[model samples]
Target: MYLTQGLHRMLQMNPAALATVFRGRRRSYGELAARVARLASGLQGLGMQVGDRVGMLGLNSDHFLEYMLGTWWGGGVLNPVNIRWSVPEIVYSLDDCDTRILLVDDNFLHMAEGIASMAKVRPVLIHAGDGPAPAGMLSLEQLIHDSAPIDDMARGGNDLASIMYTGGTTGRPKGVMQSHLNLWSSAVGRMAEHNITPNTSVLHVAPMFHTACMARVVTQVIVGQPHVFVPTFDALDVLRTIESEKVFDILLVPTMLQAMIAHPDFGKYDISSLKRLTYGASPIAAPVLERALELMPGIEFQQGYGMTETSPVISISGSENHSAAGIANGRVRSAGRPALCVTVRVVDEAGIEVPRGTVGELIARGPNVMLGYWNRPEETAEALRDGWMHTGDGAYMDEDGYLFIVDRLKDMIVTGGENVYSAEVESAVAGHPAVAACAVIGVPSEQWGEAVHAVVVLKPGLEVSSEEVIAHCRQRIAGYKCPKSVDFVNALPISGAGKVLKRELREPYWKDRKHGVN
Candidate 1:
């Protein structure tokens, strides 16, 4: 099924119903559909053909969505540029995809010009931001207003829909190719699993370039839910929106949540209107969860677990699992039951299934799994084999089917010849009163080959010593897994998606020298 079919259905059901509220502009499904259609026609008129790759470089905006959906509607593949990436990183993705039409917002106007200089094929430029379009670039409004609506679905089912570039520890980014079917089923399956209905209003705070948040947007369209969009996430702005706009639900990573609650005016916001807060992209500390519960007793926290390749959702720890009853034990730490359409298995090094309660490599098989890695057949074969997508994450399932993510297979530390899941140590350290956030990494040690190191962030006005931190962790976990050394930072490095950037944290220690991790 075409992913854009929701737009047509929404327009038919309620032409006047608000479909998007972005940057003080409200567009009903009727308005959104018309713009999307005309924009598709505009791209087609500009020589875009079926299977052509179209690159969009911009921050979150209505124009970005219109351009993306329009490109897909015209049977072209979307290549959304990561806004946080450097010029070279952006160039790599665009050049790798062989995209020829670069749709740029004001923020990237200059960068787009620089990219144009290095492109294998000269790219046609379309400007898509407020005020006057760039002098040398084609104006988006001009293109849409001058063209006729085109309704064509040349690519469907397993056809390439979009290519998302995820961070590559391999020294270069890899494009994960997702099909129309992959996306549609991800949206439908997640919606069905979460009970996200027309009455639900999802806040768009995470960057649109992220497949996790973008998939949520697609689901909103299909369910005809009103989406309240923000230019970017600001904790105070988010609280204000919830109080004034009565936002029912939102999604964010744990780091974002930690910052929000830690904001000075956090207690001042009226947040009783919120119902579900879906958290993912990183693990959340139990202390943060406890504080959030105390501050907003009415909220239900749903934990999401996935990587970009699985359309970013393998399971969601739902409302029932977030209850006070579930928090007493370690149940709150679980990532919840797998989504209806997904099958998860914890496998050993030999590719044999591990029993429940045994930690092993997490493998998945579902429609939500991507078609393959873009233009990398060997890599694709390696990633998607034996009828399952290997997640490269170590995890286990309880008898009740609750998934517990142990650690990334690459991130698991081998210290003193003992296997240690960094997540376990981080979770324990995070439970301490003085610790606000932390990252556990393996550092070089002459004695142990690799020693466990903890980089921590403490609560304001708190005095904590590295020795005390080590002692606290030592009591909770094996001494080998506990921090042999600790560094107190005001904040840990975080990625564009808001997850703690463990790789960046480890870079200081491992940059000039190398260990095993690729």
Candidate 2:
């Protein structure tokens, strides 16, 4: 069961079924397949060979899916660029993956020029959409229209399917190699655990570029359900779509859920259409969960916990525990058990298993594990050991098999379902002249799960203010990674190992809770 195999199956078994609803326009499976075949032929005609990498840079569109399937149909690897990265970051990722063909949308067309300007090797460009192609670049639609239909490339299991770049908290982004088998197994396994079917109408509120939304799409395809794509998540837009489109399922981060429930007009929409809700970018606030429960009763809530390396699904807590857990029966706070066909164990630094309910590093082993990080063997080997993907999450399993995430092993800050590494933010913050020392950590937020909070010791006589510090970091990193709030401290507590004690920083906000976080 390769990743591309589903497209062929859908084209054959359910040609007329709705595949994607984008920007209020719907595309049927048959129409999408025909288009994908044409695009595949066009790519093959452009000297695309088996195993060559093709890049995609764009917002969510019907064409994104078309190009994705077309790449695999043409026996190529898909390397979707992160639209959030700086120009240099984007160019480095493309060059690292050795991408020779790139498809760009209107929003990202300027990036093509940047890549051409910097990359030692420039890829053939194809502009995505109805617009005319830029200088020296062919329009994607024109290429598809002029080409003959081609059969599926028929790449089998374990074949390279994609090279997704995961932006690290420090240093450069690493390309996580994904195989057809990894993607297919992840999709099927998630649907199995969540009991998704063709009857499901999964909502795509998150960006498809991110692994969370991308992985969710696979299950919807496998179950042959229609996925409603929203280019980005907007609280009201999500509510409107839920009520209007009757979205049966949605996968969001805690921040998105909080915003949806807290929206002033949240009660305006009839959101009973939601059958299952899966969220797990970060820990959920108890208040948000209670409010969501109050608004939408009888809703199935599930939480999935994993990183990009684990094909993203390590464990899932579902309806069985959503409304009930222990004697509480429906406690929806837990992140559930290890997924089907997945092995999860909490381990210490020595790779020794910890006792049940003891916090430690979470390790997962399954077919869903990524192949390796592209061009970084040392880092890849460090992450994947003994056939298990080491998920750098601080978590523990209860006697009931439910997992609770206490913190992160890598100081990763998950806000709004997006990961913001402190190391990355620290690098930016360190550049400022006003700071003597700084530490970035997650603090409980009403909107975002754990907002980026920075504790800084300013140099003597420096005129830097909290706003100025955040403004400095914002210019260097993405907006989401910038600190939402700041604390001026005389000094940050350090442990014997010379590590800044995050617990000491986190205690003030979370000391009253049973756990360190809400």
CA error at residue 142 for candidate 2, angstroms: 0.9
Residue 39, model 1: lDDT of 89
Q: Each prediction's Cα lDDT score?
A: 0.84, 0.79
Where model 2 places Cα greater than 4 Å from the true spot, the runs are: 324-331, 412-518
Once fitted onto the true fold, the runs of candidate 1 whose alpha carbons sit more than 4 angstroms away are: 152-154, 512-514
Per-residue lDDT of model 1, residues 283-397, tens digit only? 7777787777677677877888888898878988887877877877578889888898999899998899999999999999999899888889999999998779999999999
The C-alpha TM-scores of every prediction are 0.96, 0.80
- Give per-residue CA lDDT, model 2, range 212-317, as digits (tens): 7778877766667787877667899899988888899998876578668767898888988888787776555454566666677788777787777877788887
Worst 10 residues of 2 by lDDT: 494-503
Candidate 2 vs. true structure, TM-score: 0.80
Output the lDDT of residue 425, model 2: 77
What TM-score quantifies how close candidate 1 is to the native fold? 0.96
